[model samples]
Target: MMTSDNERARLLPSAALDVLGNDLLLRCASYLDADGLVQLGRTSARFGIPQAGQERSLANEAARQRFRQSATEDERSRLPKYDGESDVGLPVSLTEGIDLEADWERNINPMFVTSSYKSAVAEQLRSQRTAKWGESNVHCCTYGCKDGRCDWTDWDNETGSFDWQGQEELEVSGTIGLLLDLDEGTLSVFKNGLCLGAMKEGLGGEYCWFVNVGSLCTIGISRGRAPN
Candidate 1:
């Protein structure tokens, strides 16, 4: 039986792989890491677009796993209602695209581009959908650090300096802010209506706002101005 199996394996050619459909291919991709998913998506356009399947895009599915083990079709259809310039605390479930003003401004504060100066940042948002995801996934926290681990700590070593002060932590259910400056190419974070300074920069491309959050976390985003 072993010899027969080996002989059959030798007879099967790489050409047979061409018969494999996107569904099977993507189903197999469920085991890949973020970087691996990104690579697989680039291999073909089908790997990136959403379709009638268990997991739409490989990259999106992998990111969604951080929220739920398996996402239903209803959950994917329910997206944040981005009605220009509103204070809506949208419940987030996946690391997905948020169609904002691309870059909106606020008259209330010169530091922020949103009316929701009170907001929490997450997932180290990239200006591009195909942004390189690494181990430097940024996390936010207002409280609950018992041991040496704090929630508001920045994990990215290349994010310049770790200037996150003790007072920078927000209160329970407090607002956290994130402003993506397209002109200056910087992403600034705010805690309870105060600026935490630019946490990231070098973003000269179009951005799709995304959040990487845990269970039962509600984040709100508000804009005061129109598109640029």
Candidate 2:
């Protein structure tokens, strides 16, 4: 008697994920960055792998890893989905109201270097940018600044215009991540998984998510993370 794929799946180990037991698989998954784990979960689901419990476990563990050191139990309990929609402390502007289901779905790039964010990089960059440009003219709303000016690129001498570009558009090679410090009401940029600096406006007193969509110059919160 031949077994159906579903039956075989039930009777045997997972198809590409075989060598790993559920707990072991989950443990390995715990090491993945939030985005990586999410992508893996999605891929697993699409392949008919039932990892609901394991995925939840991975997420819980990741959340703990993110907040275990600094957050109180209460704050940990209050952590919302990194999905960018649950900032309870702020007004919901049109940008914040936009659906971010697709934006947060970025695949974990192969180049990412996993590391806990440090405030020093962010502060240093902010100070440098400020020294060079005076103050950040970026106007971030509940979502974030979309005018492409937030992440300033090259300044054109002929047009006297600044070229705004997302991290991916830069000539340098690096990975970008969003660092949200809910306890501090701060949102900072992370480059290659390190803090670049805090964004000046449209943050604080509320949790906000940021992203750069469409063009190199486009910067806005699609209602999620990885603020540009």
Candidate 3:
């Protein structure tokens, strides 16, 4: 017998697909995987090859184009003006600030507690970090750590320490805040407001920060000496 969480997890993608229909669902599911449907897609008998076919049908050109045209107008009305520039100077650290916390606490927090999509992404990030760095203390590595190793220390919950080196004072932009402190040599990432997860340099100086908030995940790095 499937648990309620399992059943709901399996049904979520399907229900989302049902409401968004096949086309939008496919786009949404593209960011997701089979395990993204909770364990239901894997263990439940209700989901199978047919659902996969339905997902593919939504990916077809006709469906995609139709959704795109309809969605464009709908999205325009719903989405606020972005002004075509980064809102870095904005007073709030992220989209989830103190003002938005009340609504998020009531609505979004519950979903994160129960949603399989959140769990899947979190697990994927955890695995990726473990595989890449082994048991080392995860740091931003924004400076010229060419070999991908740093002398930073991890944070200790019990005994706090001032672990900052001269490198920490180097003012770099595009980094929202520290997610995981390197003083304690643990893999825990703090997702509090203004605090983000570990960021590592990707191909071509691109930086990726693992954020549960979705919007704060990708951060572009700019290299330069600290401003005097």
Candidate 4:
């Protein structure tokens, strides 16, 4: 029986040809790695139709990967660490003096606040309407020591970062002051002056949001008088 690698090599040529015929020899080249492209170039040369050079093949693959993995605007801003001290302070309390009843009424009733600050919050809530799920893929987080230093501490400490997958439900209100960014087909939410979570597009055009919360409880997005 043919091994998996052999099967792949045998099948890849036909697949590549079907996708990229005489019209565009570089079309299917983006899917191939260095060695695969080299083999493909050899096959093409055998047929006297060699098209892509080594540099062009490598650059195309790199470009495709970059396009696939590029982060959204919101994601770029909400990184794990900041370069300098931020003007914004952490949330005094997740839930302390928040008028849950009033906030709920405002959230559900769609009542407009007259105060400038309250209007700003309401505008933010309106902005949340644009938040949508982004690309989804298997993300692996490795926590281990490297270069004789503790690289795993970020995932080991109590307040350290952790990896998550799937739709994340968040309990946020106007009083909580959460920020959401939806750009480059990705969604990143920030709360309490920290990185709350991120979402990316997945298979079948579905998006998954992953959040690492302190406690394991059901979380959902609330905006525009509806819970997301």
Candidate 5:
């Protein structure tokens, strides 16, 4: 019974390996690391190791196991469950000194003035066919951070500075605002109150807007008809 180690040992001799075919070479390579397999392949032009089958090697499997174990430990040490911009725990007041809890509730504020503000905001959003997410002017949030490197709190906490993969480069002229069209399901960006055309189109379902700004910049969410 030839053990895996013995099979690997048999593959070391360049002269002896010339007689063996590709199938035998792959079987021997299974007990070798990626680099070791490549080295074995170079010994014989006939011993062509398929790139896709490299992971099938036992040594490479061991390497994968070690990497997964380390990644799991790091993932467990995260600070907060990042859902979106709303998860930043920032404070926002709908009116002057009026406290508003961040949660899902329709017609939340019963006060006449607050209700009027909501109505006016919704009306304005409908009239312009544009809506801004969140009630506050400043937002600190990121889109994707699943790799564990782009933690929002890990960077500057105030500005919500974090790395994110975006579809396009947003030309930032000044404090930019993201405006969404509820009817057409399109999204556009406004720089210093100037419309910069539509950024995204065919947006559906409930979507959260996130902004990653520099140290000195500010991100604000204008009041508009809240998506339901």
Candidate 6:
């Protein structure tokens, strides 16, 4: 058979990718996280346009992937998914509603949850309990410490890294809020939806949410937007 010039042209990289199309790219994206998907979109036109709707689709997929991992199958199925059609912020596990109660481990103090990735240090957690929280891959925000004021700190044991020291003299009498903006790499604290301000900036890598519950028997955590 004679080699066709048209066939050779069609077999070129771009043409081959175009033939595979967005569906193929999306299938490849399923293996990737949101960040990977965004990067893929930037690669070529065949991967799909980086438009709002397409971005939302990628985000919805990512949110579902991020959500309810530490939860039981029954709990995950029952968990509400964030409807970006109604919500203003990006769809996330928090926005989709996470049962933090189910995500906790009871200890001497009260309870502490595992990392977002659910990789907890069993021995350390067993020893220190909630005492040396910042020693692990955990992010900490204290409301009332020994100094009788709020403090912010986080750490990564693997890399020996830590930063974010924001002290606020909050009068503990109302609902407290903590928000982690992974995109901008900032953490903000609030009081009853009132934005206190960005406590930390330029945060990097993965971090788990944590708190040192001394005398408090009950801790309530809910997710939504804090007015900017």
Q: What TM-score against the true fold does each predicted structure earn?
A: 0.28, 0.26, 0.21, 0.20, 0.24, 0.36
Residue-pair clash count for candidate 6: 0
The order by descending lDDT is: 6, 1, 2, 5, 4, 3
**Clashing residue pairs, candidate 5?**
30-57, 30-58, 137-220, 138-219
Cand. 2 Cα-lDDT: 0.41
lDDT of 1 by residue, 118-219 (tens): 223213333322433323344222222122122332322322223433325444566556676656866666666666566564555433454433335445
lDDT of 5 by residue, 1-228 (tens): 656987778767765756876466546655654455445445543443224445333333332333343334433232222342221111111212222234323124333222133556434433532234323322222332122122222111233433333333344434455665656766555445556455554454334554444344333345432222
Model 2: CA > 4 A from native: 1-16, 46-228
List per-prediction Cα lDDT, in the order shown.
0.45, 0.41, 0.33, 0.35, 0.40, 0.49
lDDT of 4 by residue, 98-137 (tens): 3535656424324433323355654554353321212322
Instruction: Kindly report which residue stretches of model 1 are placed more than 4 angstroms away from their true locations once superposed.
Output: 1-167, 225-228
Better of 3 and 6 by lDDT: 6
Clashes of each: 3, 3, 9, 11, 4, 0
Q: Point out where model 6 deviates above 4 Å.
A: 1-167
Error of 5 at 73 (Å): 51
Clashes of 3: 9
TM-score-wise, the better of 1 and 6 is: 6
Q: What's the residue-level lDDT of 23 in candidate 1?
A: 52
lDDT of 3: 0.33
Off by over 4 Å in 3: 1-36, 39-43, 46-99, 102-133, 137-160, 166-176, 179-228
* Residue runs of model 5 more than 4 Å from their true location after superposition: 1-173, 216-228
In the range 78-196, model 6's lDDT, one tens digit per residue, is 34443333111222333444445564543335445433333454444445545322233435444453233544433223322223354444445456677776667777777666776
Best lDDT goes to which candidate?
6
Off by over 4 Å in 4: 1-23, 28-53, 56-59, 62-153, 160-228
